[model samples]
Each structure stands twice: as structure tokens, then as C-alpha cells.
Target: MEPDIATQNDSGQDSESGLSLRWSARLSLTTRILVVNVLAIALLAGGLFYLNNYRDRLTEERLTQARLQLTIVADALSSGDIANRDALVEQFASHLGARLRLYAPDGRKVIDSFELAEPTYQFVDPDAEPLRKDAARMLDKTIESVVFTTQIPNFSEPANDVAGAWSELETAERKSAAVSSVSYAPDRTPVIVAGKSLPDGAGSILLTANARDITRIVRAERASVLLVILVAATISILLSLFLARTIVRPIRKLAVAAVRVRMGRSDEIAIPRMPGRRDEIGQLSRALSDMSAALRHRIDATEAFAADVSHEIKNPLASLRSALEGLERVDDPDLQKQLLDVANDDVRRIDRLINDISDASRVDAELARAKFEPIDIGKMLEQLLAAREQRTSNLGVHIAFARPAKDVAKVMGDGGRLERVFGNLLDNAVSFSPEGGLVEILATPDGDEIVIHIADQGPGVAPDQREQVFQRFHSDRPDGEAFGKHSGLGLAIAKTIVEGHQGEIRILDRDGGESGACFEIRLPKAL
Candidate 1:
């Protein structure tokens, strides 16, 4: 047989949920929380990488400025006499914070800034630096490695220390314009070198500057950013752990309790309701606790039902056995016939008991899956009373239904089950009423509910027995009624169906000082 639509949908969901869900299921809640928090700080840490590009842009700007300054200085010297060129070069060197050199057209060294003036800057030897400076340089190299910054040649003076050894000057002479290049000193500081050809080919001038301040500024900025990121990351991790503790711990406890319940140890496990918390988690806790309690109640009810069924079946079986045994020992034809009738009645009673038990057992499951529609309580009662008047053999007992207006007592319920509920109640009232007595059924709307009362003018039930009458296999029939004529499950099934519909049913003393039992049923309105 083909599976129902609900079963098919459940199977499809279980199979079609794909790899991402499966993979995520393997990670604990704690790991997911940590990953989410850490990823944010990692994005913030990316700023350190951009600092490398910032340093490069600053170096390029410095190189362009130096080349322009050198070209202007060379032009000044080219327009003056050769006797004053050395003094002019020295003046430019001191002002620009660079070492300046003037060379001849044949690439011969003419004047050197250091020979004429005190040196303005010197290259730093990394090995002779303090520990703090060493740490700073290490950090610079680490950042360069991480960002894959382009390699620059290390700055070194050639053995000849002349114009022929300087590549920038050769390029400047050939191009007859300013040219510049960058290199790194021993301490990983930038070295900017700019050379320009003098006006009318007087010579090429070279200016070299140790741009240590640029490296210092970039490193300091990087350190500050790194410190902030470290602090933020530490706080993020701690908070993530704290959040995991608060969330995962309670969920874990709930999971363990559910497992125990599933293992049939519900008697020993008490699922926490977490009443102090007012969040979704607390709601889940209370919901699960209530569900477990309901399950336990259901289990107990099933056990009691089985016991009652066994006891009820045994009495009829024993009577059947005794009648059959007595028939074998008797010889009189009338006695044998009487025994045969008793055996037939006991067999019928057993069949009736089995059918009633089956119906009682199925009431809950059927109502759970039943689809409810809007039913006018007054109209249903009118039709029911008409049908009963036609078929009912109890002509001496009259049933009067005080039906309300159309649509006034509308309710949402399974029509067939509701019909059965009222049918059972009406039959019960008819069986209890005296000859020429009245059985009254009244349906009316009371605000948000449809109220129904089935009262009979018969020996009323004692106040103490009202609750017991709704329990399974509880038969308290009227005196002189045939034994086993009613299985006693009708009222119990009625109560179960009413409760399943989110309604209520109760037995009360008849109003207006009447001597009868009143069965009152209240169902929610359709709207």
C-alpha cells in the first residue's frame, strides 16, 4: 500500500536535507559560537595588511620630491662658475638632509658633499640597536613576510664610491631627466636615491636620503592597531565562552533528561522547567516537561485499560463455561434448553464486551487525526431527535429538544464523533427515564461556548458516583435493567472525545429542583 502524504513528507525531509546540515550537526554549539565571534575580530585584524601599501605610497612620494629638488640644485650649479659648485652642493645637502654628489660629463667625481660639509644622516646598523628596536624590526619583517611585499635591493656603497658605481646617475645621464630608485638599509629602513642630469649636460647630481622616520611611523601605527585587536579578540573569546556556558549547559541537561525518558526511566527523571528564566529556552524546558508528564499518564492509562478488559472478559467466559458444563450433566429437555439459552446469552455478552472495548481503545487515536468543521449544534440536535423518534422503541419516554436559533450554537468539531457523543447521552437518558417520563436536551450559545444539557426524569446518580460514571467499564445501570445490555464505555468515550475537542463535560444536579441527573457539555464556538 502507498504511504500517506504525511508519512511521505516526513521521509522526504529526513533524506533530502543535504551535506551542509549533516556537516554542521557534527560540531558542538560551543565551537559554532567561538567560530562566529572569532571571525569578526579576524576581519578587523586585516587592517594590519593595508599598512604595507600605505608605507609604499609614502616612499614613492618622498622619492618624487627628492628627484625634483636635485634637478633644481643641479640647474643652479650649472648656471654658476665651477669655483662655487662645491659650496652650492654642500648647502643643498645640509638643507635637504641628504648626501649630495656632483660628477663630470665623463662620469668623473667632481665634488662630494661629505668632504665639504658635516654629514646630515647616517645608515643604522641593526645588530647594534636596543632590544625594543630589535623587536620593532622583527615585527616589520613579519608584516612584510605576511603581505609578500616586493623585494628591494639592500643599500651598499661600491668600493670606488664614484659616479661610475651609481646606477641612478647613469640612468639620469642617458635620459637627461630626473630618475629615482628605492632600497632598504640594514635596519629594514627605506633608502631613497634620486639623480638628475645637470642643465646643458654639466653633469648628473645624486641625492641619497635615509628615510628612517617613514619606517618608524608605519611600525608605530601597526603596533597600536595590533594592540587594539589583541584586546578586542581576548574579550570576544571570553564572551563567546561565557555565552556557550549559559546556553549549551542547560540544553545538555535537557538532552540527558530526554534520553532517560526515552529509555523508559521517566519515573526517575525530572525534566527541569527552569521557572526562573523567561526566555525561549525556558519555554522549551517547560514544554518538554509537560510532554513527559503526559506520556507517563498515557502509559498508566493503557496499563489500567488492559487490566479492566481482562477482568471483564473473564466473568462472561466463566459463565459460559459453567452453562456448557451443566448442559452435559442434565437429562431433562427443559433444563437443557435453558442451559443452551444461558450459553448463547453469555456468548453474546462477550461479543458485545469485545466490541465496546475496541471502540473505547480507538476513541483517542481517531479523534487525534479527525478533521473538524463548523457544526450547528441546534441543527444537529434537531436531526438527531427526529431520527431517534422514528427508530426508538421507548415510546413511553418522550424526548424534548429545546433547540436554539440557527447558527447561534455553532461549534467546530468532528460531526460524526459529536453525533455519537450525543447519541450515547440521549440513549443513556432514555434508558434511565420512567414510563411517560421526559428526557430534555437543550442547546444554547453562552458567549464563546455552545452549552448542551441532557437531563432525564429518573433515579438520579449520587453526587459521589458522578465522577466514577465517566471511567472505563463503569456500569451503574438502573434497577430492573437487563444485565450486560450496555457495555458502560459510552460515557467514557464521550468524555474522551469532548476533551480532545478542547471542550468540557460534567454531570450536575438537574436545575429547577428537578429529580434527575444533568449531563452538561460545553464546546468552544466555531469562531
Candidate 2:
């Protein structure tokens, strides 16, 4: 028979399904959390590293400026080309925009820029910008902003007035060292000071540059950086929310749907479709929805099976009841024997119906959990034909076995179940065959599959009833066959077992459209 497309595709589908299941199982909760948070953590770490290096550069630039000023002044002090030391000191301090102090070894100040510069200065108060003309005139004599230089000229104990500056210069002179430091002056101005000892004990030259400019620039840049960081954080938060909605929320919904399916409410649960999205989550959602639909279909099929079982069992029960009632009333000895026989037959028929019904009901679940092993199809069919031929010897019917090639019909499935499947098919073929007719069982390799054919020389099945023959309790036994001899479950059970093994089974017209039914089964070859 030609293979059914669904059955033929099952092997490939199973392999793909297994891979997907393995990947889903590997993604635990912790792994998912790490995947979601890694980007944000990396961004924060990179920003921090960049800011740290930038601050270091800023600090080094400020220090380098101070060092350069100190070196120039120290070099001038040791130079013999200058005729006026005071003029040279003044020129250096003005050009560099710094405070320069030259102290002799005894702590005597030779030249001080603070002492030389004019004391008077004008300052504007921003708070007085809107004052009236009369108000401004009245406050002209008042000390609005300008202040005089506090450095006293030629004062004794100059070391006490500018202690930090004096201490650095004295340390440089005594130790013949060079020093660079950042500190605050007495007036609270930020200062970058560098002092180096002059050559030949010419005293120490101390250069102090106001660090306010660099400090203010750094503070402004830091403020700007903080603003940028805040903006970036806001954007990241928005993007994270969008990602969470797309990924995390859908996954959570799928989780909930799975839980509902497990709780036996799959039919009641509705999974949202995300067909447009081409992402991992979208694939997962689609898979979950398919699983739910399959589960619902199984549930519906199970319910129908139960209903059919009830209807089938009630028939023999009603016959047994009627036979028993008739036996209780009949008086003639022959009539009583006939009634007893009918009751006995009805009891056996009921028993057969119950057993077959039980087996059919458990077929789906059993096959789902059935473990499979490789079995040689040719050998299995040979053994089955031998058993059937032995049993049916007196009936003058025989099941004959044939193989296309020796040792080439190996297939993967439950060996016992496969044996049962062929056993049923051969039994049905033998029952349908004429007296002394041969029922042929043939196994052949068909590409990746092993195909088995069971042919009989009986009246063939009609085209319209071909599909209905495998339905539960649906039968078309020959005229001479005894009533209640068949439960009509053999073909149905065989079909289920073949499908469970990822194989296909079908009824085929015998060669040249002659009389008789031919059952064909196709099973995947063992690797």
C-alpha cells in the first residue's frame, strides 16, 4: 500500500521535536535570568571603566601643568644671565599666571608676586545687577567685592603667614628635594603647588597655580557626564521594559498555559498567537499552542472511545440477559439446552468484548510509553506464519511467509507489539481465505523502511468501506463464520501499533484487482 503522509513524516518530525525539547530543557530559570541581565551589566561596567580612566587623565593633566611651572621658575633662579632677579621673577609670575615665591636658605623672601601686585581692584556683585542708579551710587563707597592682598611685605616670621608654602620650600631646600602637591591656600582657593630646590643651594623656588579653573572644568564635565548617564539609564529602562514585554512576558504566559494543560484544563486555556514575530519566543509560543491543540484532540478522541466502548459492551450484555430470562421460563429439555448454549455463547462473547475493549482503550497510552528494540521483520513474520500454520492445519488454511532478501528486514519497534500486529493481520487474512487457501506474508525492504504485505484469497473489501473497516466493532465477517467469533478489534489494534512504531498500515487491492484483501504495513528500518 502507498504510505500515509503523516505516518511517513513521523520519523523526521520526532528527531526535530527531540532537539527542540532538549534545548528547552537546558534553559533553566537561572540561565534565562543571566541571559536577560548580561547586556545591562556589561553596559554599566563599561561606563564605569571609561569614567575612571577619564578622571585619572584629568588629574594627571592638572599635575603636569603645575610641574612645568615649577621647573621653569627653578631653572630661572639658577640661571646667571638675568641681571635683575626681581624683574625676572615678576615676568615669570605674570606670564605663567601664577604666584611665585623665592626664599633664601634663611627663610628670607627675595621676591613675592602677591606683595608686588597693586592692591586695589573692582568686583561686581551679581545680586546688585538690578539695583537702581541712586542705590548703586550710595554703595560705591562700600566694600562691595574687592579685597586687598593679605601677604605683608618684608614681614618677620613669613613662615607663619604662609605656613604650607613655606614648609614645602624649606623641605625642598633642606632635603634638596622636588615636591608637587595639591592643597588649599589660607583664603580657601584651590592650589596646585610644585617646589624644587635651586642648584648650588641658591634657596628654593615655590610655584603655586590656582587649580580653580581645572577643578571647575572637571566639576562641569562630571555634571554633564552624570546627566548623560541619567539619560542613558532612562533609555535603557524603556528598552528593557519593551524587551520584557516581548520575551519575558510571553514566556511567562506560555508557562501558565503549560501549567493549565498539565492541570487538565487545556481545552479551556487560550494561547495568544504571535505569528508575526520571528524570534525564539515566537517559535516557543507556536510550539506550545500546537501542543495544546494536540492535547485537546487526544482528550476528545478518548471521550469518543469511551462512548463507543459503552455502546459495544451493552449489546452482549443485553443478549446474555435475554438468554438467561428465556432459560428460566422454557420447559422442554432440548429447548433448555439450546437456551443454555445461547447463554454460554453470550457470556463468552461479552468476555471477549470486554477484553478487546480494555486493550483498545489502553492502546494509545501504552504505545506512548512503549520502549522499542530492533527486531528482524523477516524472522518475526516467519515465526508468526509457522505458529499460525500449525494452529490452522485442521482448517486446511495456511499462512505462508516470504522475504525479499535474507537478513535485510530489520526494523525498530517493540518486538512483542510488532509480533502482535502481524499476528492479527495474518489471522484476519486466514479467516477471510477459502478452504485450503494460502495466506501469504511477505517482507521487503523499501528505501529506509521495511514493508510487510499480508494477502488473502477472499472476497475483497469494497472501496467505500475500506476506511470504515478499521473502526471499533465494525465488521464484515464471511457468511459461514460463526457469530461472536470475532471482536472486530484486530485490524484497529494493528493499525494503532503500526502507527505508534512510526509506520503506516493500509488495505490494498490484490494484484490485478482480483478477489481478496491485501494488508500492507511499512515500518522504519533499524539503524
Indicate which candidate wins on lDDT. 1
Residue 72 alpha-carbon offset, candidate 1, angstroms: 3.0
* lDDT, candidate 1, 1-527, per-residue tens: 34212212445655444434565666889999998899999999888888888999999999999888887887788788788878888888989989988788787877889888888888888888999888987777887899898888999988887787999988888887889999989888988998888777677788999998899889888889999999999999999999888899999888878777877754767789999979888999999999988888898899999999999899989999999999889999999999999899899999999998998899889988999999998999898888877886555798888879889999999999999899899888888899899998899888989899999998888989999999999999989988888888899999998998999999999988799999999999999
Candidate 1: residue 496 lDDT (0-100): 92
lDDT of 2 by residue, 6-77 (tens): 312545555455445455455755455555555665565454335434544665677677776787778766
Per-model TM against the reference: 0.92, 0.75
Judged by whole-model lDDT over C-alpha atoms, candidate 1 comes out at 0.88
Q: Model 2 segments beyond 4 Å from truth?
A: 1-68, 71-75, 78-83, 103-110, 118-165, 184-190, 196-205, 216-235, 259-279, 398-400
Residue pairs with backbone overlap in model 2: none
